[model samples]
Target: MDDNRTDKVLLYKGVKTMIFAVLTLFMGPIILSMALSQPENKLYIPLLVVGLLICAFAVFLIFKGIRLIMNSMFKK
Candidate 1:
């Protein structure tokens, strides 16, 4: 790969990783607050489950981005 293309790829992966990390951090508090605020509501369970899934997806995205960056750096 050319230097320009490699730099762009690295930048994209880094940015994507940061975005996923931010989403995970942001969603955690929102999910907790929602669960705590509506303890009596039966819907909270579903909401919590959905929130957990979203967080998990964000984490997966983060790992994927990291893997891409690492592969780019170390590939023979």
Candidate 2:
């Protein structure tokens, strides 16, 4: 019999990563907007940089999560 069962542990990890990525996605835009609204602030540049980095990280996390979920479902 071919046992093609999904790996629950990896699937769970992927779900968790996706959730975190969603939160980061929201946070990045909020931070970027806040920084844009206060261009004169000394922390504006740093906040903008951080926001961009967070946005990039969210994208990475999304890709990673999808890959993990796919692996869990398809890998032996």
Candidate 2 residue 53 Cα shift, in angstroms, is 0.4
Q: Model 2: per-residue lDDT, tens digit, 1-76?
A: 8879999999999999999999999999999999999999999999999999999999999999999999999985
lDDT of 2: 0.97
Q: Which portions of model 1 show Cα errors greater than 4 Å?
A: 1-7
Per-model C-alpha RMSD? 3.3, 1.0
| Error at 14, model 2, angstroms | 0.4
Question: How would you encode candidate 1's per-residue C-alpha lDDT over 1-76 as one tens digit per residue?
Answer: 5453355677577777867778787897688679868979998888888778777877777777777776666554
Alpha-carbon runs more than 4 Å astray in model 2: none
- List of clashing residue pairs for candidate 1: none
For each candidate, what TM-score against the reference?
Answer: 0.65, 0.95
Question: What lDDT score is found at residue 1 in candidate 2?
Answer: 85
